[model samples]
Target: MSSGPTGQPSLVRTGAKAGLAFAGSAIKGGLLGLILGGGVFFFYLGQLKGPGNTAARAGGAGAILALVTSPPLLVAVLLLLFVVVYAMLGVQRGRTKAMQHLVAARGEAVSERLAGAIAGRIEAMPRTHGTLQRAADWLSVDALSKQLAPVLGEGKAVRSVVGFVLNRLPMSDMLAEWQEGRAAHGAPVAAEGAAQDPALRALLTRRINETLQEMSTPSRKPLYIALGAHAVLLGVGLWLVN
Candidate 1:
């Protein structure tokens, strides 16, 4: 109901923000690992050379250099790899959440449009005359299923409506099935003549198909953000390893 230019941020902007936050967290984690690893390396080096002779000091220094340049560095690289994996997962989760939010926002609009379209179609039907046509004209979205019951049957009408409204979206099947199940448990049985009307069902399906086609806009901003985030994370990880 609330339509404003600044209602919510766009999906790409949200995803970009999420990516940056994940990158920051991952860099901090990598730095912390490097610090802890370096601390342990230095602690062992100090332990290797106590108050001893110059020969012992020389040997300890050699050992420290060898350890630092080899196994400890390798461990640091491995830690960076772990961080890279963690960052990737975090970014993916963030992107998925952003996509869900975008779809939900769009879906509300689609539902409203679909409801108005269907109600208008129902009222315009030549077969639906007299009081039924008047009722359809005044039907609210909440009462649409009930109004449709006389024409399309109770269970089939709800499923048909839900499927028509949601079938093109990502979670369409899930939502339709949930609505159908909910309706089956509580909706009243349809009039005896309801099942004979295929015209209304066909009309609803056609409208949905048309709406879906209209909704399909080509946008790759999310994919670009995901790729860019991965590249940045990989670069940071490699830099940390070096």
Candidate 2:
């Protein structure tokens, strides 16, 4: 029922929520893997048939087309995809820890600053300790985003970091809003002398904002995925169609 000093359950932590996420991620990962693997298999099948064999030639073309558009490359693609999704979950999970830290840090930040405590808690919290680490990572992103929203508004640097995370950009239009707000208040870094130092917070916020903006634009990712998925399907379709 309670965790030991290690902060983990005496027993395994699996349950309905964990199970569902695992199943979902597994299904997703598997489907993607299958599509990728199948694409490769079909491509090879056609290649083995050689150019002399017209059917095989056409089939190979389909396979190559399929591979071209897919997300995970034929080599190391699965692990890579899993890791990307997993890291997302880690970031999300980190936020839950962030909230707990925030709550604890809130009381402390009033008297002191939370940067160290927040960072420490984040480091100490169990890193998605489960087979479904990837799923956990995915879930954590939402949690972190929600928890950090208010603090982000006040911390320009932190906000910029968030934005950069989202888009890998140094700055973005999102920062404009924060800048305007600061200008309106006439204190670009109000908490500069404070323990938390509002300016530093702003930097982090800015980076995070970048990441958020990038994520908001679903067109780039979904469209790319769609095109890649179809490329494989298209090639296969031709073979079957013929």
Candidate 3:
């Protein structure tokens, strides 16, 4: 894996990008839902005014308040739920793309022995409990472990190796730098200190690339199914209301 001195592929960076994309989708969907729901509410309110003065007879303000607080708000909330589900699916798709890009950047796989050796070296280094244990735990690689368990089998050793890479090693700094570069063009680059440590850099890059490749696969099918179900429920609700 030949990352530039300043630019390394990182799961953290990929995740950040996915999160931002989801946020944008959510904001757009929410605004659209608000507009549509408001329009429906007003149209119904106007129609109600014409027929038998039903709204006025029912204590005008109370009827209007009830209408505003009920159907329109409910629709808006349902639409928001739909939007969140779709946006989550979009994030999954974005993650797959980001993984593919990272895998392509690496071009070839680094050997398992080499990766293991680097991991072992990092684990042997002295470090604070907070930095090593807690920091590794923070990466939430256990989520990855859960996903991969059926394929890779369950083991404490696997978890340890993951923790070593994520917490004990210098990969976090490289990942941080990658995130900075993504946030701004021509950002101040990370120093060449990591680049100088070829073994560490190569191992970190391989782990990140391999992890991305694995995650990019068909494991996200469940998310798509859930999103579809949410959309269907929203559609059914709207139809019933209409």
Candidate 4:
């Protein structure tokens, strides 16, 4: 939504576009799933129930029906499987694309928030490209954990995030740089030098750990559908055998 001069929020077309994309994908996905699943069923049925014996003149039509049905079943199963696999792949790809958007949005959010927090405390921290890159490499785990937290839950996310943050958040480097050069030339010896500021580092470490402990969780829709499909297939196969 965008704010107008009158202060009322206006609906943007982004939501409409997203909705249409989702709907189209959903229809395509459904068709694919049905075809693939139905094909599997047809093939399995054909294989289990082979063409029955039919003598000339009396049951010729019956025998012909079985043969015709069996091959068609196989074809149906093939079609179904093809559709299902493709649909699933499409959905997964779509999800990844959507996530990229979210990642970009959230990344900006995190950066802006962090900048605000450090605005007054730090001075002339001249944005060196590789500095943050190196910091990110060092902070990979924490960064990943934080990124995953919203989707994966807070408890687990926090612990994972904190662990990485602790290992990556080198207070010594920050403190040493601060105490030695421009920022803190004669401010205070920075408790522990660049090579060893364990205390402040520990605080960040603790937070990551705590966050990991409170991690968020993933959805269970796929799991449930998978279990149901397996159960249905197993039951049907067993019934046919019996």
Candidate 5:
């Protein structure tokens, strides 16, 4: 069936070639996430039951360890971690893959045209929109995603394009920019020139580059997520082991 203005169905948009690429990237990242994540958790678990603690809980440790480290329990923990990490990276990989697919479908000229269109809209955002409003409408990942949907269609390419164009900065970053600039001065003076202020623009533009690099390099998001997830499992592992 046709889809959106592209007339290309979602399946066609992904294409077999792109799908395989996405899977390959996801699996590779998943394995990395698994190895790194598992290593950290294992290190912590060892520490928890390490030399000092192990001697103290020597008698109890064996029984608890048996239960916690059992084939079933170990598999479940690793499986959960793998799945979460896989999904996390999968979204990013899919976006990247979809964009490649989109480029294939539309060709470089059309792709650039689309890029120009989105950039034009963002650059044209009126100062009257207010700092927060402008940010909400044009300065956020989510907002860019929404904008990409209509022009880029509903494919994963939308997210990919958004990632390329904007960084997923925490609202606090912008809030800090706003607070330090405007609130501290005891005036919302920045509001009038927000969309056009060279300095503010430079700062946010710099932040955008920072975000883009994070998405491209992928930074440490997966590992960070892995750490947080394993922290919770650490408690459960201990509980079951005990």
Candidate 6:
């Protein structure tokens, strides 16, 4: 919502737009349900009624519709829909929250491992153009683990930090340069620190708020596919009941 004199009007307009959008979405969902329900009944009712019972086919059709659209069945379908939607949408949120927990619980260890793995590699790269990807690779491989094992030791903890660096948060390259008080662009360090003042921890925590904001959100295709699968399963159950 915007502020100032036009705020009230803008808010009203926004609310109206949201209402319309929701209504349109509901209509589409209803239409899709009707179409799927009709298709399922058409395919199954014929086999259920049999050929000699053609006279009662129409009646059986009605009975099937009534059964499938009953309050209990409808409620089940709606609940399943909600579950599928939530599962699809909540995956990213859950993954991010878990990552947050990992960082909080093991920040120091992970940062030290990360710095051990990639810091020397980045610093030894002759300040090339592809310093970033190389830094990521160094963190990814295990061969470099030996380089810093004497100090930081080696363990499964490195995997956790590497995944975060390459996938969730991207600060691998900066840690090395920060330690040396320089950057790939040949810029000298300005202030030379963060709150904790350790290079690895600084790089890990620095811009973390902003980097997390850039985490990729799951797309809608999987959501649609999940909903379709749920609808099919519900159809199968209804068929069994009939």
lDDT of each: 0.43, 0.38, 0.46, 0.41, 0.53, 0.46
Q: What is the TM-score of each candidate against the true structure?
A: 0.25, 0.30, 0.37, 0.31, 0.37, 0.36
Error of 4 at 119 (Å): 9.3
- Distance from true position, residue 155, model 5, in Å? 3.3
How do the residues 1-242 of candidate 2 rate in per-residue lDDT, one tens digit apiece?
A: 22233322211232233335445545554555456545554554443323333432355776565445432223223323433443344343433333333223232221122232222222333433331222222323334444454433233323433333433533234334445666887854232123443543454444443444443232334435544764564455445434
Off by over 4 Å in 1: 8-20, 37-242
User: In candidate 6, what are the lDDT values of residues 1-242, reduced to their tens digit?
Assistant: 22244444543453355345445544544554455544544444343433333333346676457446454344344534554354434444444444444444344444554554454454445454545555555455455445534433344433434544556654544555564665554654333121233454446444443443333232456547656776676666556446
Clashes of 4: 23
- Model 5: per-residue lDDT, tens digit, 1-242? 23365555544545666777667777776776666665655654553433444434455766567546454346345645654675577667655654465445543333343344433453465655344444435555565566545545655545655555543555445546745776676765343323444445445555554544444343355557666766666656666445
Which structure among the candidates has the greatest TM-score?
3
Where is model 2 more than 4 Å wrong at Cα?
1-28, 31-51, 54-179, 188-242
Q: What's model 5's lDDT at 171?
A: 42
Error of 4 at 197 (Å): 17
lDDT (C-alpha) at residue 237 in model 2: 41
Candidate 6: the clashing residue pairs are none
**Model 3 quality (TM-score):** 0.37
TM-score of candidate 6 on Cα atoms, chains taken together: 0.36
Model 2 residue-pair collision total: 44
Query: Over 4 Å off in model 4, which ranges?
Result: 1-11, 50-93, 100-242
lDDT for residue 39 in candidate 3, whole number 0-100: 47
lDDT tens digits, residues 86-133, model 4?
467446544433333332323333233232222222222334543432
lDDT of 4 at 179: 42
The positional error of residue 161 in candidate 1, measured at the CA in angstroms, is 26
